[model samples]
Target: MDQPITRRDFLNGIAIGATAAAASGPLLAASMPDPAARALPGASPLPPAAQDAFGYYPPLLTGLRGSHPGSFEDAHALRDSHTWPTATDTGQEYDLIIVGGGISGLAAAHFYRAQAKTESRILILDNHDDFGGHAKRNEFNLDGHLNILNGGTLEIDSPRPYGPIAANLLTTLGVDVPKLIKTTQNLEFYQSLGLQSGVFFDRETFGADKLSVGLERGPLKELLAQAPLSAAARAAIVQIQEGNIDYLPGLSSDEKKQRLSRMSYEAFLRDVVHVEPAVLNFYYARTMGEWGVGTDAVSALDCWGIGLPGFQGMNLAKGSIRRMGFTPAGYEDTGGSFRLHFPDGNATIARLLVRNLIPSAVPGSSAEDVVTARVNYAQLDRDAAPVRVRLNSIAIRARHIGDPKSADQVEVTYLRGGQAFTTRARGVVLAGYNMMIPYLCPELPAAQKDALHKLVKTPLVYTSVALRNRQAFDTLKVHRVYAPGSFHTYFHLNPHVHVGRYESPKSVNDPILVHMVRTPCKRGLPEHEQNRAGRAELLATSFETFERNIREQLGRTLAAGGFDPARDITAITVNRWPHGYAPEYNPLFDPDVPEAERPHVVGRARFGRIAIANSDSGGAAYTDTAIDQGHRAVVELLQG
Candidate 1:
């Protein structure tokens, strides 16, 4: 069973809690470590803050001077530096050593701490001073008003959106989770193309045009009953919900097999509840934007797993909603989409996890106790097999370098700090992008990388802009805009946390921070081939190019919306994750059966140690997938 947060831990928890509460609104910020302070014996100064965090300029950088940026190589150097404590010195061995400090690594650590029976010593190495890779938070003072901005993974389907996870993670770590996932009254849908109108028969806006309807609160049954529909339509919808037919409208030849493998959602929509084509299109757009796949892309059997069913009448579990930081004016507004979040988005959870991993890191304890408990990275001598984890490191090259039988294990060399180093492990986890996987494991026959490369890739550029006035655009009902000509999507995010400008009683002139996200670059096709021996391969491009695309698109949006692009801007920052997200199912794979059971080697493990766990590994990039894989990997080690 998971241990409860002890009383002694409450002191430190309270400090972080107060900090989180203070930064509860939007503009939840995090302190950026100095880039110059990162220098080791021979290592060069690390990149500047802007390079590391997309040039997010909040006041956290004050007096924080460091230049050494942490990378995979740093872990190896820390291991050799004789700093901190380690199991190797105590003659102890661990089952695993997770390299990355992102969700994958943290989840693995959480699982191992809870389940593994092998007396495992979990060591997670991240070059950054803190954890929570992409899911991070930022806070700022826009014209004297405090606000928070989510740097990554802003919205999530947390078991409780505003309770334990959000509150504890943020307050405990001084992160503003509540501000990121801001609570809101309702969602407003806007037409992207002034599409043909439709109708809804039931709920608060009964017997109204779909384009003009706005749904208010009601139970699932009540809401469905409110929608105006013929008896035939209702029955057909019921059948679809009851798992009797396929309702997804569009399906390609290959998609038919995948959809029919289970119940089809299309059958229900056509034969049962009988939603009109226009209504279906609206539903399709919203669902696609949210799930990253068209409605037909999923089986009807899987539909209930997403948002609440429209027919079910807004079925919210009891006592799940909290009213903290919600404004009467925002809630009374006609159109808006809102939720609450912690300061660093998911990084809040990551920080909480790392605190637990450190030895004796209880609340109010001296920094020395925390330091003493830390498992030092240095103590890992090649001869010292007892060392469980070696962080701040990377395996530069791994290969079947010599004769097959005698040299069974792959030879791996890595750089640590400024020095080159070498080591060999029984197995490895290629838990990064698939693009990099082929380069490391070339022994696979048929150039598997090429096939993987053929799969369609989507590029996204996320931007966060904190404004000086929250009410400037309050008159606009729609928070999101879909610009078909320029990028995939754009939205004015309503942060989950309580931004002081939006919440403070004394503040009438607070600046609003509007975070706009879009896709600017072309990434769907495979890279052109350079050699004749093999087909053209796909090469990934830099993130800067992606950001440029977004800037260009934003300029168009300014022109279309009639906003002053130059004058309206107060403080603007851009964060680019070059490899944003991967799509599900490779273009070549059979979707009918599980990828693992199919003939191809997609999403499979080789031998035991060299396991791959990326969003692309499962061919599906999702929070749950990452968590499931992390647990699965831990289980694999435990079973071994």
Candidate 2:
């Protein structure tokens, strides 16, 4: 199963967000609890030492991912209250040492090698068991064939066209997005099978557990007739979807858009369009998957930008809106970008980069062959490799060797196994969480540090379930479902993708992977606050809770189709991203500030020999942004 589909998670998951924290904020430690009380219900048992030692294969590992255990304990301890750890010098040095092994970090390494000397040794330290940051690839071997799905970043896409640097980077990696999409994706497979998009109204939220198929393709009358919505809601939905009367009739397109930019999508529907409250459920989850905030938290302009209903009559021009020193990306953001999702999503990009940077790590020479190539994790951090990627290594501190203005080298102290080791580098790139940068390098200016702290990431989960078969979905004629009230708001059978040497299941009896998405956000709070609350909720949620909800929701939604959760689920991988999507700018909650003064911009400014890079630093949750940021960070350092 694919993890919570991020907007870039391929299908463009941006949905309604609302859900209060069930437990206290994870950072504030004094809440109270014994060891047993605090233990996560389904916290995975520590794998054997050898498993992570030389046989480290994280793609095959299932269960909790995306900030898995032993990954964040040190960072948390340091964040709670800074206690710098003393380190034993490793007598090792590098030209560059990147603190993240995600896309941006890998790209930084690739760029550094290209510009610097060929023998310039670079090291990428990551806390996770595997690299690629949020672009995670999950693998499941059933009987003989392998089932693969992305646990995180899913597509080489964005709201707008990829800039030259990012676009050229993909081409250089042998990833022809258009060519790959044609060769790998089967968009008509579900259509041929007569399946369509649907909604599952649970009894708790809709008064009855019902599945309504073809909500987009089939007759709207059938859905209206079957929905347990109030009569007023039914009529309102029809008017919104099919009617043409403009709510903001008198205002010009720009004026209407300006007003929309300042309000939430929910307000546009309820107060402006005069829709009944019950109608919100039908459209709530659409925005949740993208930013983890519901219609109430999202800008009305954004709803219109994404083709949400009730906007046709307004006749707003297909463009952007600027108000109060900010530009809303709704209409302006959606444009051309090649969409390509590999068998393992953007992890193919990571593997391709790894292959380019560290020769034999991923053997294949082309992006096509990389789909089925098993990575040699053992070779990742070899001493002989000029560019080494060290996993399961948490960098506790990255500080300049001396004064702010004069330091030419940096010291990076990290915890791997149980001891602290220090490595020196000519320059360093902090490519991890933007919010955590303040803790890593405390010597930065107070305002810069403060700016970095404001980049709060939205928390979410991407769950993948390996099923015995997709009979339930096929029977119900639903390739996807939108369940607003369910724990997982959206789920679907992964589209059949045949690429390289890998092929998706072709038979109804063949095993399939179902992907589910959950963005836990609290209502009423501002966007950043909502994201913070969502992160806390995700941190407190147990895999047991996740699994139970998965079973219950699937059972209820697919019962009519004879789906049996207990018997059909062969495996489950819950990719919990407590700090999920990189915080994107939102006109509703974020302050209207000049572009250069924005948190991402101010925070990303180079500090001496240190530079920042990541999608977070760019304030856009897309692969292109990460690549762009990485290139920029590298260029800044090289120029100096």
Q: RMSD in angstroms, all models?
A: 14.5, 6.5
Which ranges of candidate 2 are over 4 A from the true structure? Answer: 1-54, 82-85, 322-334
Best by lDDT: 2
**CA shift of 150, model 2, Å:** 0.7
TM-score of each: 0.53, 0.92
Model 1 spans with C-alpha error above 4 angstroms: 1-95, 113-131, 138-146, 158-288, 291-340, 359-394, 398-412, 415-420, 423-427, 444-457, 498-508, 520-563, 586-591, 598-602
Clashes of each: 97, 21
Indicate the TM-score of model 2: 0.92
lDDT tens per residue, model 2, 1-640: 1122335222212222223322222211111112223222222232222222444568877777778877888899889985655777888889999999999999999998888755799989999888999999988887578999989887876777888989999999998888887888886787789887777776666777788887656557667788888878878888888889889989999899889988898888878877766677666666876667777788888767656667778788877754443222532555537677787779999999999998767887888889999887656766666888878788888888888679889999998766688899999999999999999988889999999999988888888888899898889888888787778888888768888889999888899898888888776788888888777778887766676677777877888899887787777788988888888778887878878889999999999999999999998888988999999999998987
Query: Could you tell me how far off, in angstroms, the CA of residue 634 lies in candidate 2 after the best superposition?
Result: 0.4
Superposition error at 520 for model 2 (Å): 0.8
Candidate 1 worst ten-residue window by lDDT: 8-17
